[model samples]
Target: MPEVFTAYVRIVDGFNRRVGRIVMYGIFVLMGILLYSSMSKTMFLPAHWTLEMAQFVMAGYYLLGGAYSLQLDSHVRMDLLYGRWSPKTKAVVDVVTILMLFVYLFFLLYGGVSSTAYALQYSETSYSSWSPYMAPVKIVMVIGIALMFLQATSILIKDIAVAIGRPLP
Candidate 1:
């Protein structure tokens, strides 16, 4: 069972990492497009709108990259106390952190859904020419939070395996 679970985590983490990389590339392309639009007089929209699009893309990029960041162990952490812990102690701390993250993400998902619903109910739109519905962005927040939560679960499972004297399959 541990082997199967570990294999599943590896596969999912790989897939998410690839998806995150694609998202990052898309962000770069979007930035280039925005920059081109800004520099070209032929473009109808104002420069501010292009800036807004860049901001939107950046937000998406961060959200989508979160799971991959966790998989890579690249997320920022304060090591002031954690660095002193033994391997087993570190595993325990990791489990605790994962639980906290799970709870936080649960709330974030709930809040995101609520916000999106409200936006949809009120027919929210951008204050500029684009007039994009805000609900879509809010929905993406839910997806991002959910993905982060899943990544936390994967880490927690690995930590548990280590704590139990397993080789992580």
Candidate 2:
């Protein structure tokens, strides 16, 4: 059973790592394309399109990078106090923080789903001339929030196991 659980964890971790890298790289590529388009637009099309593309790229970058940031533990934190704690204490703090994040992200996911549904129903699009499909971008928020939530849950589970002395497989 422990071996099976270990395998599961490894599989999940590997999958998240791969997905994170893909999303991060995808954002970079998208940004590059947007940059080139904007540069070309300065001479060809309207300048407004460049702003729209920039906005889309920025939103996409943040959403897609969220899970990767969490996975890498690169997100900002107030370590001034947390850094002083012992391993066990740190584990406890981590568990608590994960719980809080889980709750917050769950709410975000709920809201995102609702918003996506509304957008879908209304056939939402940007009010600007560039008017790309807003539904897709909105949907990405749900995916990003859900992924972050899952990562938080996974960390919380591992931290709880450690706190109880069994530890994670």
Candidate 3:
């Protein structure tokens, strides 16, 4: 509808797309970690970090890619009534219902930021034997959640545009 909103959508969409593309390769990293874990278990003593590292990578992969998934409309939905709706109807529905998503994302982001702050302040570590520092992953979580929030806002703007018959490119 406005140049500012159009710019925001473009920038957020482009950045998230790049991030998602890069993060997609994380699956290979996870596989490599698992492969090494298996080999080490058979050939030598199992490493303490492999399991936990894999978990971290998986979390980063999904959480970081969340905005991209939303942009692509790849996130799961009920689709019961949505699939039958006309484009303009869908945009109107999305404009209204997206408020709930914003609320949810706001709470999630708040909690993530608070937890990340605590982790950074206390130099928190996992309870696992390896006990890796928790701040890095917590920071990643906060960043990912923030990106999702931005993407959700962009979606709302686009939906508004569509509802008003000024659909963005």
Using TM-score as the measure, the top candidate is 3
- Model 1, TM vs. native: 0.83
How far residue 160's Cα lies from its native spot in candidate 1, in Å, is: 0.8
Q: TM-score for all predictions?
A: 0.83, 0.85, 0.98
RMSD of each: 2.7, 2.4, 0.8
Candidate ranking under lDDT, highest first, comes to: 3, 1, 2
The best candidate in terms of lDDT: 3
lDDT of 1: 0.78
Decide which is better by TM-score, 1 or 3.
Answer: 3
Candidate 1: stretches off by over 4 Å: 1-4, 37-45
Task: Estimate candidate 3's RMSD in Å.
Answer: 0.8
lDDT by residue (tens digit), candidate 2, 7-85: 6556656666777887776766666767778677777754556667667766767776777687788999888888888
TM-score of 3: 0.98
lDDT of 1 by residue, 71-118 (tens): 888889999998898888899888888888888888888888898899
TM-score of 2: 0.85
Which pairs of residues clash in candidate 3, taking residues 3 or more apart in a chain or in different chains? none
What is the per-residue lDDT of model 3 for residues 16-64, given as tens digits with 9 covering 90 to 100? 9999999999999999999999999999999999999999999999999
